[model samples]
Target chain A: MDLLSDLFLAKAAFIGIVFAITLGIAAYSTYFERKIAAFMQDRIGPDRAGPFGILQPLADAVKMFMKEDFIPANSNKWLFIAGPCLSMLTALMTSAVVPFGDTVTIGGVTFDLQGIDVNIGILWVFGIVSLGVYGILIGGWASNNKYSLLGAIRAASQNISYELAMGLAIIAILLFTGSLSTKAIVEGQQNGHWNIFYQPLGFIIFLICAFAECNRTPFDLPECETELIGGYHTEYSSMKLGFYLFAEYINMFISGAVMATLYFGGYDYPGIDFVTAQFGNNIAVFVGMGALIGKALLFVFVFMWVRWTLPRFRYDQLMGLGWAGLIPLSMYNVVVTAFGILIGKPFTAGIVGVVLLILGLLIHDQLFVKKKIA
Target chain B: MVISNIWYFLSGLTLLSALMVVLAKNPIHSVLYLVFTFFCISGHYVLLNAQFLMAVNIIVYAGAIMVLFLFVIMMFDLKKNQPESKSSLTKLAGSVVAGTLLVLLIALLRKNNLPAPSEVNFKSQTGMVETLGKILYTEYLLPFELISILFFVAMVGAVMLGKREAGERNF
Candidate 1:
């Protein structure tokens, strides 16, 4: 009972730490995204608030909070309020399953550097992310605006569409690790045996689906300003609009963490054994965690990079890419992964994936060429 | 004792939310209540230590299906077209049908005289993913495969119906 209680206390504390980390990273992501965009576009970014605008997010937060909490007269007040609350809640919940670092022992009491350890960690993330649709859907419907409704519908469809391919893509990881737990997946990838090398095709499909699921460009038609003015959050003002935007950033952060954990040998730095042998487990654990965070941040940079570089896909093109392209590719990956496991040659899976990818590119090229001729 | 208390609370919330689903005036409110009901049931599944079932239940019902329900309901102009109220006779007929279902359920339960799920001895691992997956793919492989094929067919049918023609927008 005492041990259990102590464990509970540790868990509660870790939850607080994880929440702080997720929110802090999400806050800084906004700053970094702008800085990255500015560099890409050859312009100076937000350098006003503090050194290189480190305090810009804080300023933005204050501005968001100080602004008038406006609601349209015709809007469904209750659901309008529920929308952002649900959005933020679901985005935050996905962080609970991520194993941040190895355990730390003090006074012979071990503390896990995770929010919660569950056997179904990845599935829990999946389920929570699927629920994220309700936030935008509710907010859009409640707004009583055409653009909001249209955006919400598009977002719901987009999320659901991409989820199919995403689940199938992750099947390759599950095949490789043979476990649904994120910790187990990470453990399987220890000493640089990452799933990415084996499941490159799966990773690419997952990356695209992740982009779509997060509603980031080139899949961000739901919120593209050129088409729909503010889209789903059109009628939202102040913190509510901030919640929608912040939720996107949070989703991006969480997805990046998930991708890192899934494919980038999470919490496993190169020469980890040497580090642990030299500096001790505590220092090594910190280094491992730092590496993991650095990796997640790298993926976040990729998200922003893609957002700035790629143009938004037309609605049909986006749907066509998801249903016609990624879904089939993912299913093929699943089949080849099954065969690779059966044959006891993991490299066979990578080879098959590459072969299939080449064939797909050729087919798409041929189709494009024929369309041009016609 | 605390566990039982949580189970009771969760089951109570599940029932309340399920009732609210039928009673809510707004279609969207009804859908949301249904989602809450699914969530509370997921809580019950967690209480029973069926983590996989809880996740799948929430994912399939509260997440995917309910979102589609919300999507369709959101598109409807609710203020313009109110549902027509049934007459007294129609209400009586509906109540009669519901009453018959209740009576049949009671009779079936009394006939079986089976113990409640809580009273039955069950293993902690019964609802685990490994056990479930093994049983699904091994013992129930054919049925599982058939059901998946059925779903695939449905998906294909949806795509066929929704497929865009030349010079036409699908959406």
Candidate 2:
């Protein structure tokens, strides 16, 4: 009974730890994004709140809380409430499947640093991400605004298009690792050789799709405020608006963590197990958790970096990237990877995949790329 | 049994939404209510562990189909108006027919003494999409092919219905 209670306590603590970290990181990422953008543009951003704007997110939270919560007169009150709730719920739920670290044995008990290490973790993550469309769509439709409706349509189509590439990219990784669990995927990359080396094309495709799916620029067409006037969240105010904004940041962080877990070495640095052998499993797990978090944060920084570096994509350009660029690249990536696996020549397979990708691109350009020479 | 509880809840939602689709005085409200009915039916699909079907149902029916409905409703410039009142005799007769149908259904249920369906182990090892594809392509292939033909015929019928005749005139 004591053992069971201890086990439960550890599990609860693990969840609590992640919840606090993710929520905190998500809140701060908003501030960090602004700061990064400011630095890029050579202007100070949000430094008035505290030392270098560290407390800016806190101040923003206070403002959001104190603001008057208003519901539109014409809206269906029930579904309007359900919209943001569902959005936030689905966004946070994806983290449950992400494995943050290996097992840490403390005192005599070992606990995994994941909420639930289910076998179908990858599918669960994808499924939950797909559900996020409802939040944007329902929120926009409930607003009864033309811009919001257009934004929702853009978001839905964007998700559908990019999801195909994302799924295809994931198939390459699955083919190589032959595992769907995030933990297993990470472990599969343990031998100082990440799947990224074997499947560079898949990695690039997944990264681009990740950017689009999370609605970061240059793919943030849904909320292109200059064009669509706040897109899905135009009608939302106070906590509803907060939920939409917070969900975006949380999703960014979660997807970053997923990328780190799936493609990067995922805490299997040069000599992780060597240290584990000398010191112990607990210390190793602690270090591994820190390393994984570091990697995830690095990816998060990259997300913000890319956002500031790139201009917002035009609507047509965005769709063209998904269909014309990413889709065929992903398909060819899959076919080549499958052949490589069958033939047991990963190096040759990677080269062949790259060649096929370039060939596909050349064909696309020849066929669809309008002749500017004319 | 848990699923039965969910079924009860979702069925109530579907029925209520369907009723609202007809009873709503505003045409836009009726269209919105119809979307809600589609969502509830999608919930029923999810409860059945038909995850792929559930997503497709929502994406196709609620998202795409209802967006078209909303577009038409918006384009039509429907004014909000109260429903036309029915005469007491007409209301009474409608209720009588509905009540008779309810009674007939209850009588049939009682007379048939339908045995409780033995619970089958329906949990699938494969993903919902894979299982659905396997079934549709293998065991249900003929029916699936027939359905495609039926869909094609329906498409032709719709075009015929929607097409304007050259000789038609406004009186």
Return the top candidate by lDDT.
Answer: 1
Per-residue lDDT of candidate 1, residues A1-374 (tens digit):
34368898898888998788889999999999999999999999999999879999999999999999999999999999999999999999999888889998877889998887888988998999899999999999999999999999999999999999999998888998888999999999999888888888889999999999899989998886777888999999999999999999999988999999999988998999999999999889989888888888888999999989988899999989998899998998988888888889887778876887799889988887656444
Note the residue pairs that clash in candidate 1: none
Evaluated on CA atoms against the true complex, candidate 2 attains a DockQ of 0.11
Model 2, C-alpha of A315: deviation from truth (Å): 0.9
Off by over 4 Å in 2: A1-12, A72-81, A107-110, A265-267, A359-374, B1-171
Model 2's C-alpha root-mean-square deviation from the true structure amounts to: 6.1
Tens-place lDDT per residue, model 1, B1-171, is: 477887888888888988899888899999999999998988888877889999999989988999989987887889887799889999999999999999999999999999667755768888889999999999999999999999999989997897678999645
Local error of candidate 1 at residue A4 (angstroms): 8.8
Off by over 4 Å in 1: A1-4, A363-368, A371-374, B103-112, B116-121, B164-171
The CAPRI category of model 2 is incorrect
Residues A41-140 of candidate 2: C-alpha lDDT, one tens digit per residue: 9999989898998999999999998888988898767667877887888788888878878887777888888998766577777777766777787777
Docking category of candidate 1: medium
